[model samples]
Target: MFDIIIRSATQRKVRSGLTVSGIALGIFALVVMGAMSENFNQTFENSMSLTSDKIRVFAESGMFGGGLTDDKVPDVKRVPGVKDAYGILLTTFDEDQMGMSGKQIFALPPEKSRIALDPVKLKAGRFLEPGDTYQILVGTSIAGEYDLQIGSKLEIHDKNFTVIGILEYTGSFFDSTAAIPLETAQDIYNLEHSLSTIFAVPEEGIDSDILAKRIELNVKGTSTLSPRELQEQASQSLLIFSVITISSALLAAIIGGLSVMNTMLMSVTERTREFGILRAMGAETKDILLITLGEAALLGIIGGLLGIGIGSAAVYLINLWLAGKGIILFAITQRLLVVALLFATVIGTISGLYPAYRATKMSPMEALRYG
Candidate 1:
């Protein structure tokens, strides 16, 4: 049946090409949009998973690594429910100041933050060590972007720092962050003993919410967040993106289906004489319907393959472009590919139903004479 459909399509090359293009376009759009949504979900989960067992302390008012002080750490640790706490310093260096464009610096004390740094697996070199002033650990994306290796220099605030390690693709915040010693960060930013945030671990039996509340009360001028709160924030951030991607992909699918329906209808009309001849030669109405539907499904499959191939490449290119900045905005997964193909096939099968029915309704003698 596939061979027959392909033969027929080859005979009407222009029509088949146009029909395939429509399905391909729709599948392409669906794949890219779906991959982006997948990226958001994956990154969100990775981030949430990284901090699920801990609580985050921040300044009462500020965003993106607030100016929370390390002084709050002792107070937070003194809270009964808190087991351990450590401060992390963060600062974004720009092209003018650091000779690097919009790079975020993630600094922590290595000895105290071992558990904290555990998630940040190294790709090429070593993690930050104690007394490691002027050494940096960068994300894989950034390392690849600048062709950086061990001993490569990164200039920040007119000071040259060496890259000692490249971090694994964490699929979290650190994927886009560069790490250094806590004290080094303070010096370069001129923020002596200042921290951007404090990460805390609650006692074994202590609830994160209760620990957060206790820390807030014990440490003044501070804000606290449990994993649940971060989950809520992530969900809120992805809501708009999810809606837009779903709506656009669905719209494209509908348009593609319509294109298939129109093209199939025309093909049935043009093939009336051929169908009539087949019927006269002992072909049943079911045979006519089967042939027409099979052709439509074949077009869909070809289009889907074309679309998926192109879409996957597009996703790679997009990720590659942002990888330099230590970011990935799209991810192509095997599940997404299967879904795209199935969606295309469904659209094709449904679109062919009406045209197939029309062909079945044609009388052999009348169709042969009319055409």
Candidate 2:
């Protein structure tokens, strides 16, 4: 039976090749899109890990509203079930300064700052100490890109600060940012006594949602966002990625399936007398059905394999391009490859269903009399 299917496909090389190419194109899209989405999710999760268990307090009642007044940090700490809280000052430094285009900056009190940016191990020098005015910490990415070292001076807001530390490569968003003392940042940004956001941790076993709610109800002119809320937002964002991949995959599949169906339909028509001969030689309906479906599935399998090879090469090239920027944003995993192949095979078999059924329904004598 398999030999017969192989012979049939080989005899109709042009149609078979076209059908396979279509299915392969669909799988290629599927693999490429799937890999990109996975890489995006991974990067996003890594960046979010730091605040995974903490809640963010925003002043002015909206998630991205105006900065919270510096005085709100103590008030938030006093809230019941609140274990600890710290205010963070986040902003973009002058792009022209030090050739850092829109460099992300985070500032917190040297003494109270527990944010290590990925538990950020230090590569050189030491972290900022209390009362260390005009001091800064730089990530490995920035240090390498700018040739910065301990004792290197970075000019921010018309003031030069000595780099006290170079953080280890964290592969997260932090790698592109620099850290500064809280007071220094406030003075430079002219945001005296103002905070971008507050990070709050709940007491052991305290419900984060309840704590967030209580903070919102008690803290006047403030809004609270819990980790759960962040997770929900992440889900929504990831869903967009999924929708994009799935929609493209579906469209590709449909095109590939139609091609397979057309090819198989033509083949069945051309093989009427051929099927009649097989039936007269004691071939069963199921045998004809399997042969037709098998031929289509064979095309699908070949196409899927081709697609995987092409997609893998594309992913490799993409990663190479991103490597220079300290990024690896595409990956083609084993599971994704397996799933792509299975999907291709299923699509091929399904597209041949009608034609296979039609072939089985033919009367041997009538088929023999016809073409």
lDDT of model 2 at residue 88? 86
Query: Which residues of candidate 1, in runs, are more than 4 Å off?
Result: 1-4, 62-67, 93-103, 123-126, 190-194, 274-288, 317-329, 361-369
> What lDDT does the true structure give each of the candidates?
0.83, 0.83
In order of appearance, the predictions have TM-scores of 0.83, 0.85
**Candidate 2 lDDT by residue in tens digits, 141-253:** 66766678899998877899899988877656677678899889999888898888888889999999999999988888888889999889888989898788868876887
Task: Estimate the overall C-alpha local distance difference test score of candidate 2.
Answer: 0.83
Mark the regions of model 2 whose C-alpha exceeds 4 Å error after superposition.
Answer: 92-103, 112-126, 131-172, 175-177
Can you write out model 1's per-residue Cα lDDT over 1-371, one digit (the tens) per residue? 56777788778889889888989998999999999998888877886887788888998985454568778888888989888899988777554546244457778986654577676677878877787999888876678767889999988668888999888887876666778889988987888988888989888988898889888888898888887887787788888887899679968976888888998999999989988899899998778878999888888888889889999999899878877665678889889999999988888988999999999999999888866
Tell me how candidate 1 scores on lDDT: 0.83
